[model samples]
Target chain A: MRNLVVLWMLILSMSIMAQMRDFQVITPELTGTLRLGLIRQNESLWLSDYKKIAAKKNGTETIYTIKHEWLNKGSIRISTKPLLDTHGFVMKIETTDIPASIHLFWAFGGCLGEVINLTGDENSLKPEFCKDNVFSIEGNSFTVYYGTSRKLRILEALVPPDSDVRLSDAHQQQTPLSFFNSGKKNDAPALAALTPLKNNEAVYFCFYKQNPKADYNYFMLPELYKKGSYEVHSETQWMKSTPD
Target chain B: MFKPLLIICFALFVGMYIKAATYNVKDFGAKANGKNIDSPAINAAILEAEKNGGGTIYIPAGEYLCYSIRLKSNITIYLESGATIVAAFPGAGKDEGYDAAEPNPDNPYQDFGHSHWQNSLMWAIGEKNITICGSGLIYGKGLTREESRLPGVGNKAIAFKECHNITLRDISMLRCGHFAVIATGVDNLTITNVRVDTNRDGFDIDCCRNVRITDCSINTPWDDAIVLKSSYGLRYFKDTQNVTISGCYVSGFDNGTAYTAQWETDEPQAPDHGFTVGRIKFGTESSGGFKNIAITNCIFERCRGLALEVVDGGHMEDLVISNITMRDIVNAPIFLRLGARQRSPKSTPIGAMRRININNINVYNADSQYSCIISGIPGHCIEDVSFSNINIYFKGGFTEEDGKRVVPENETVYPEPWMFGTIPASGFYVRHARKILFDNVRFHFAEKDKRPLFIFDDVEKSDISNIRVNGIKVENPFTAH
Candidate 1:
């Protein structure tokens, strides 16, 4: 009976999930780019939206950065050119500074939005940013005409930005290392014949792109006989003569 | 004379009492046409039988291409051998003043859309004790030459919305141009021994509870073979709880590399994802996520990525996967990833509390490009995952560099093409996970492969024990495929 009730509640909540709420995407920013001195000399690849309530990756939110915290709602507006590639008052921030309530403001829509061009006149920030609960941004550093003069946005957290954090070799030296690579050619015959390779349980395929230009980003797919994921089964303890 | 008449009347009364009441569509004169037919005559026959309180309405075998036929409570539509219900074209029979939907307290299905609401083959609403049995077939010939490409036209074989105690057995649903069979927002539904061959998803059970699917065969052209969806109506993630899929054979969805086209188009159209289970939508609706589904005793072949996924912001809990087998898959054997780092549900307070247990499985041959990917949010880790007693085979192997190990493709063939995408891995990889355990697991590859058997990123509280790796084949005696 209790299981039935729980299931009924689960079904009820699913209908609730289908119910919509009030939200909007208001801010945006594009951070870094593969710039070239040769052809068009593109300044940056737009990555994040400063106008959006949220930021992407490990970025800042619109609430913490505009010198004030602000909530977003539906029906937002976009300016033709924000910041300066610079001709007019392209950016204006109603809220000029980060607010006290916010923890971390996401950048771009979520990634850290880098506001580059503050031409002599044009601005992305609106004047009544804090009073009207909005912050418009404009930059002069790159070509942003290809982007939305204004686009929808989603607000996230307003976390302070930090540099990339890759782990140091503190544990690498202490931990034991294992390797399992089963590419083609190491067919079933080779796998069975290879000595000193038996009973080597647990396999992980580490996929890393040497550079950003690389297309291969190795991700996991499911297989019946491949036994791709590592697990500890509690129900079935009987061992079969399966090779790992 | 009077005494004789009384005996005759008594005998007639006894016969009427003994025989169960039955009504046939032929009694009311019904015809089955591929086009130009009314579903009401057959529906009326089913209802009259139910009004007489529970009986069977038999569909004689022939091609009856008709629009939505609403069902009633306490009824069983028995498809006598060779009965086939072909899906009628959408907007075909709406010319006259025909009213399809009217609200009724006795029927809660009225709150939901019509079965023909989107041009489905057979749809039922708010029905109870409904059983569709016998060796019949429902065909949605969406791939036909006379088909029209109209928007809002959904071609599904059978759709049951807000129904209860529904069972469909010994049936074949084929060539549903879009979705083959979908039972959404209903309860106590069981589908068994049904073979579905379709151009789209074979079977989809979304946003319901106590659903069981067993001993079924699903052959699909794209996306999941037997998919369990947690959300509906382009809304936020909805929790699809207590789903069990066992003893099923699945194949196909071998279309490769989804990044071949642009993400968005300027036209106003339904979002396209013949392959996506959950997606980020422009919020017109949202509530909770999905959780507590179990999939066991299944077989897979020629698939693309992880058959099980927690990609969208749906709530997932207690996902138990065991006794599985696989062979000749295109991509990694398992891919459990949160969407783009920024698009992860963490920032939006949408938690996908995922837990996976994969045990007693064998994977024969895996040839994947960029095999396994795990990219999830940091703080809201994909928690409580376990993989034990497993064996995997990656056909090719790798070699050790000056001090670093490198995959074979990194040096020769692939060389990391900027445009074509990257090459995948030969073994286990996890990211942003917590309470993860790996015991008695083996990853076997030859000595010529490059990649780590285990890689962790932004993970908290992980234990890897009883692990064995092959193809190390070095002098150190620590490495050996």
Candidate 2:
């Protein structure tokens, strides 16, 4: 009975801590060159204001949706839905107005994953290999390793037409997108276009992990991998998906 | 009465210990979603930590969009491996961006960018014993790269001013708007194992003392990768002294692609004439002197060569560079200049540069025409410089006429290799200097050249030993002084 009381007290404290600090979990995994659509409603608008607006937990999967607004001009939305059984996620993008050009720039070392490969949306866009990717780091690989074990692989899914991606350097001096070719890894964070915004014009992109399953824990969420399983396992089961 | 006082003292000591607690930003109403601006919660957590006489603020693996994270002394922000602190873009509302750049009455002396520090994603002013460490990322997504003062644009990733005992380690910055890290008037700084691959300047250690930067990799195509400056940003002649930069690599690659081993392609697009302004430099801003500096065991690739300048009235002394390697150099392999641009106080005179020792440098595929140059102003000559065990390979296609070309004395112009306009010497051009020595140095060219390897003008007390041209011992590889 005394042991049961101790266990109950521990549970009570845990619940209290969770209730006290209910900050939302922002996805740090998606980084580097972001995608923004240029649209014209009244004047010219670029969907540069990107922010995560909502997050929902279903089963072992969490879905995060980001909204992009062009300064009271227009709105666009994107969502990252993690898969319950794989190291992958589905990205759904919705456009409101037509954008002129799309620009993409990959960050040299960021959380988007190592050895990224993109598929989906009919594979209309393909990245080329570049040779100028050389850097030196101490006690780690030159390529940034994400997560605790650093085994996550970021895979791209879709690329819309009228898309152009390039490698740009130098702050304050804008390098034209024509300077670089579409390369993979840090070289190829590509941009795509969603022109002629019409009703119900939604596109899909999937950035899933391939052939990587590791169990680890970090300070922010130490209980994430507490089960020591490579698969997603959570005691707090949530709804997998709800009809819209 | 004594027993009561002792008890009270013990209680107070214990209370102090209890107050120093670990504050998690999430607990203080910080939503880790990449959308919400959580600067207030994070700042509150920091305030709570500060109130407790300094503590650790732990941020877990998640995306946190923040607007300006003001720092405090004696506080350590430990980001879990997957955690990221992202800067928010403008257009949220008015009064949202970083506090506009601090107004400096001494602004005209420097560029508009160098005069301020408050317009940044993360800034600390007049703090001490501060550290921002972890395997986390600082993504300057919404930060602007504009040099001019735009009230709504955030320019820098991390800026520290007038702080001491600063330690920045294991942080990766991407596309930092203007500069990845800018620390001015900071003392006793140790920045190690930091990776910066961005669009602009990497690490600008300005007006600092007792700085040790090691094991850092900076890949910036448009600006100096790692620079040491002594600007009048502090409005004084505080010297940058006792600095050591070792075990570092500076390279120029396409933006967003360095070290991932991806994007490996033939005929890769070169950035700006296949020459990146990526090099290690000292003082484009030299209001204060630089002394007791050493740069060793470093590598430079696909970029401009090493530049050491004292153009703005600042005395530089006791500098040593050794064990350096270079590849795919597009311009001169080395440039040492002592000029009289004199952007310092009117009372300050032209600076003096002396006692520079360079050893064990190897270069491959250097531009043959531009070659290496060490020049001083007409009257103010560089003194007591020596080079040993240096081997350089050039893409030589120069004729005797190219060798006889008289490089102009554009002393006041910005000190750059191309500024001299294709020097005559295929190996080195020494002018307006004294006590110069070259021992065991060889200059190799891909194509045979008619010009002598070295040129000397207005040189005094020159000593050359074991000099070779295309692997053959020449009677005098240096001539036409």
Candidate 3:
């Protein structure tokens, strides 16, 4: 009987560990390396200042929730998961309150060599080699290829239907991402200013390191994180948990 | 002189015999009371008429509660001015309801209401040269508006399948169940001066050909007023061709109010929580196609606008819509979509939409959230569409922020304006189209809106001239590659 009990406990622990492998709590160290904030009334509120409350595992993603008392009377949750068959990650930003704007700034140390706008105007496919410039996208989605030293990073961002998108240098202290440190002049971090989200709305962003030899399917990347798979939990679930 | 006199006498005798073939339900023991089920007596009269090689079945002024009134070919059901046929409720005993819904092996493609013909207040199958006329009322008091498989629940007021040369005129329907009239695979059908104040779809003309629907007043707050569909309910693909709907009035008023002219607004929303859906549309179910259709001189009040959708693996071509005026429009004034729902057999290909011409339209108090959308899927572009002499006034409050929103390529989902939330443009949003033209079009907003008048994405060979916004002339506003 003692041996059988030990085997049962071992099996239960192994199953729990297997389930836990699908989720990873985003630590403070990881959040520090990234710049994220909300832009409201032409002011940038950094995510670093938000109080991290709880981290929960939901399906194939890990949800990290953070709240601000005076922002919009609700919390902001960031759910992220790595791509199953690729070397990238998809992150989604969902809010419980309606903000003036939801912004994301991705800093890549130095200025990108070339910016290739895929879904733009007649000037699409024309390479622009600029360090600190902002490009106005006419549509709600921006799919761009950034060239660096011996590597190409592809990023695709999708906002709510009918919203606009902008790709700008992170060094410029704009209303969207001004709270982040204004790096040196050569730092051209991509900033996407999504339109203000309604309560319980979400925006998705994906980043991938392209393989030089293989053909990259640009259109299929967004389908990896389709909106139907992302579940929006009730605000009461997050409100009931005590702040860490 | 004797032979000529004999021939004249014989002709007079035959004429008099032909004139005496009118069968009356009251003579067949129908009481015409409001309580008793009079369908057996009515059916007996119909049988007597049919036995004499078809004649007129006359129903005079009275209220008759009935169950299923089976219809035969070569018969005319004529009702007098005050005649009303009320649908009776199904009873709990065995074999006590309307005729059991006939088993249809092709029931997979369409809804349950479209698949069955026997479970109705009146039904005709494979019949021809049938006419139902006279100013009378058909009040479906006990039919169900919902789709069900229960033993004793009838859904359609009148259903005809595979019938030809059918005419329904000068009749009124009230509180009809799933559909006021559903005609599938019916050809040479004519409906004129028919009024319907119903709970669900007023008319579903499906898989039909050579149809003429004119001078009708239809009010359906919960569903479509007059919709033309080509569903695969007949187990075969057929086109709804040579159709004309002219001089009709469609509205989304409360049930039983349009006939009374009250126009009540107490029920602001439909059961689906969307705005009231009462408009002329084509094909939520289109397995076959639509061709040579023309709609002219239609008035819409307090309802959604004209929608032309070909989602299910079918082709829509050669349509001309003109002389339309709308007030208190709820959604897009004109929505055209060529989607790839592919709700047919696995061998069917995606559908196509082309060669549509619309002109001389005036709309007032339109919703600002959705623009007049004309969208097609990625590879399948809507081809050769033209709009001329159009004027629309929108209730606009869209800011610059609203214009920046994205529109998803809902390739296979149900097509509706609200499927994509707020459109980026205030006036017109055209995407994935080819060879489009706009001339003498004006857009006026009641309030200030910051979005552009037009937004075109992936469109080719577009021609724009004489376009005005708020009385100010504007050039081609914005185009995305």
Query: Quick one: best lDDT, which candidate?
Result: 3
lDDT of 2 by residue, B66-182 (tens): 888889999888888989998876542456666667667676556656678888898999998888999999888767553323355577899999999999989888878768999
Q: For model 2 chain B, where is the 10-residue window of minimal lDDT?
A: B263-272
Candidate 3 or 1, higher TM-score:
3
Which window of ten consecutive residues has the lowest lDDT sum in model 2 chain A?
Answer: A1-10
> Who wins the TM-score comparison?
2
TM-score of chain B of 1: 0.74
| Candidate 3: residue B44 Cα off by (Å) | 1.5
Count of clashes, each model: 161, 21, 9
- Model 1, position B21, has a per-residue lDDT of 54
lDDT of 1 by residue, A137-163 (tens): 101011111121122121111111121
Tens-place lDDT per residue, model 3, A21-129, is: 1111111111101235566545565443443445565555656666555445777676665554334456677777645454443322122333222221121111133
lDDT of each: 0.42, 0.65, 0.71
For model 2, state the Cα shift of residue B408 in Å: 1.1
Task: Report the lDDT tens digits of candidate 1 across residue range B1-481.
Answer: 9999999999998777544454455454456555544456676887787778877777777666555566777777766677777654443223321223222221111112211223455667667888887787777642211111222233456777677898888888766654566676768889899877655456766667888889987655343567665433322334567878889866553211111222221111111211222111111111234567777788775443344444334566787878878765545666554432112233544445467787877676765344444434555577788888877766654433311423221111111111113333345555667887877777665344654456566677888777666623222112321
Candidates ranked by lDDT = 3, 2, 1
Superposed by TM-score, candidate 1 places the C-alpha of residue B88 at a distance from the truth, in angstroms, of 2.7
DockQ of candidates 1 onward, in order?
Answer: 0.01, 0.02, 0.01
